[model samples]
Target: MNFRKVRHVVRREYLESVRKRSFLLGLVATPLMMGAMIFLPFVSEGLVSQEEMRVSILDRTGRYGAALIADASPDLILTLAPPGMAEEELDARVAAEVLTGWILIPEDFAETGECTYRSGSITNLAVLESLRTRLGLSLAGAKAQELGLPSEDVESLLRPAEMRTVRVGHAGAREGDFTQVYLRAVMLVMTMFFALIPTGQILMRSVIEEKSNRVIEVLLSSVTPLELMVGKIIGLGAVGLTLLGAWASVGVLLSLRLGTSLPISGGEIGMFVLYFLPGYFFFAALLGSIGSICSAERDAQPFLMPISLTLILPVMMGMAIAQAPDHWVARAFSFFPPLTPSLMLFRYAIKEPPAWEILATWTTLVLATIAMFGVSARVFRVGILMTGKRPTLPEIARWARER
Candidate 1:
């Protein structure tokens, strides 16, 4: 193998990919989309209409109506029901949109402790919850008064307890909430998954295009097929790494600016690289071989679908894996090469596994990746020159077995 020729091929492939307009646009757009996904909900919440809702309370007992009105928020326009107003009349008023809702307290002396709420739309959960809370608080205060206890003591008893989460680690305890940690872990896995698929498809399409245009013929004259293949993989792998580096830098800057930090340690980043490199090469080799076999993008879909589905399987089961990182099923998946990268990273994000398990999983993945590359090379060498209808499974197998 000529190292000089391989270097030339690597440089050519890398420069060609990074210069494309699509690549440049994607470099900027991906992070913006991710940021939107993260922050848009909060922004939308703030933008929700703050219009006040009108509500009428009919207190047949007349004892709790004043307390309910006093406790209501400014956003709620609470009023006493008109004396002797019929229920049917109130329903007509609600249907006419004069009142957002009306509450009725039974005439019985608080024996059943039940109330009825009627509204044209019960879908406004915030208003419904607020009404329930205030009504419950008023009833509790009345009960406390009857027992000769203070209303403040009853109010304090009704307040929910606040709890803080602290994660204890070898480095010491730090405040880490589940949502932040989960998002960071999911982002890491998503970055890897998204990066690999596009780059692998690019590799496949590049090979098919070059073959169709007879560019591969020109290149093979200067370098062996093996050299060309290895060079392309390394070059495109570099492209993926470049993308990841840029995104990581952006993430760091955002974290600093927003005063929100990801709980990712340097060791986690190292593990990501270890899994990512082999995972990319494995998929790249597979896609490259498939590209060498087919003459068109449409011809490649049947071959690509299974691989794409396999890649997505772990992501579909991500929630389950996160919830039970140490489960036997998750542990088993971490050793399966196709799932190892994403699943292991997900599990590690939830809770770091023991050293021996990590070592074993990495070893299994690397060896499988090596074997896949070896087979893909054999198929690539034979199929790169073949043209016509796509070959069958047996034909591809025969190509791999040829000496």
Candidate 2:
């Protein structure tokens, strides 16, 4: 109820957090790390030494081995291995640093056309795909030229061609691109990953300290339990915002340095911050509630495990949705409250969600945040004074539902 007190507390919390060495280091380091994460890959791709990628092929197809090499890019190195060489020998070659990897075209490979790979190391997928595609094109071109017969027809067969790809949804609706949906999912999930754990730790530490030092008793005198809870949530919530803002500023600077465009707009950033604040407030309240219900840090374990579990779900969902953004299963995670912010962010980043879905998702989230606060406040009120024993679920429920 005291604006002055809230402001005072908020100022103190912000100042203290900003003064921490970790915060300072983050402010300085985040930009550089972000820059590297953005710039290095592109830089590597463009400016990397034009050393060829040598892939050895043991061919079963009498006519196809040379065709694959001819079709490859100038940067590719295609070597032919003699027949009867064991894969172990090839691996030894790689181990001895004489070769990178090899592919085997078995005796039946000419008929079935399947390829086998032997390697001491996992190769870059892009490189593998490129080799396979170029080889296929070269062999196809060879066959076409052979069929064309005359020199003039062979020239025609060599002409460059273009192709366009389109994917249709279930209704045959032209889903031009659902990548926005994908980007949104990726961003949201990543944001949560970077946001939740540290923020939750802040909440837990705040509660544990208060419980240990008995400061909650004094604070409860001046402000009601609800006020104290809200203040802590707001205070720590601001810290999370500050950390995210610093990280984002560094990201922007790095992107600029790297000449990489950030997919998020000012409007999107504002929306994300908007969503993130409420989401953290919600989770902070839950974590603080758990922390309050415990008598000591040791007692916080059983209570803390569920928060850990809740955190894990979204990461699990992120892995699943990365492959198929439009899958109903992915959509279901987007609506799940614990995972919603991350999943929704990813969805929005990849593609703008229909207005109704966005509205409905947050509407549910806000309601949940409100309920969590209520439960948190009760546990904080009852468990603040009690010590020596962690409150059981029934006790926490009773305290929360107390008249």
Note the Cα lDDT for every prediction shown: 0.83, 0.68
Compute the lDDT of residue 195 as modeled in candidate 2.
Answer: 66
Write one digit per residue (lDDT tens) for candidate 1, span 25-88.
7689877776686568656755542667889988898888888888667778999996578989
Q: After superposition, which runs of candidate 2 have C-alpha atoms over 4 Å from their true positions?
A: 25-53, 57-62, 71-75, 80-97, 101-124, 149-188, 256-260, 302-312
Residue 104 deviation, candidate 1, in Å? 5.3
Instruction: Give Cα distance to truth, residue 54, candidate 1, Å.
Output: 5.0
Q: Can you write out model 2's per-residue Cα lDDT over 1-403, one digit (the tens) per residue?
A: 7877777666766677668887677556654664475457657865543656677887766566776766556776778777667778887887786776788777665346577776665646667777676655555565666675675675476665865434432223233344444444444555565566566766677778887898877877787767777777777777777778777776789789999777556546755865786688778888888778776777767656676566546445655555556677767766777766766776555445677887888888888888888778888888878888776778878998985
- Per-candidate TM-score against the hidden true structure: 0.84, 0.78
| TM-score leader | 1
Q: What TM-score does structure 1 among the candidates reach?
A: 0.84
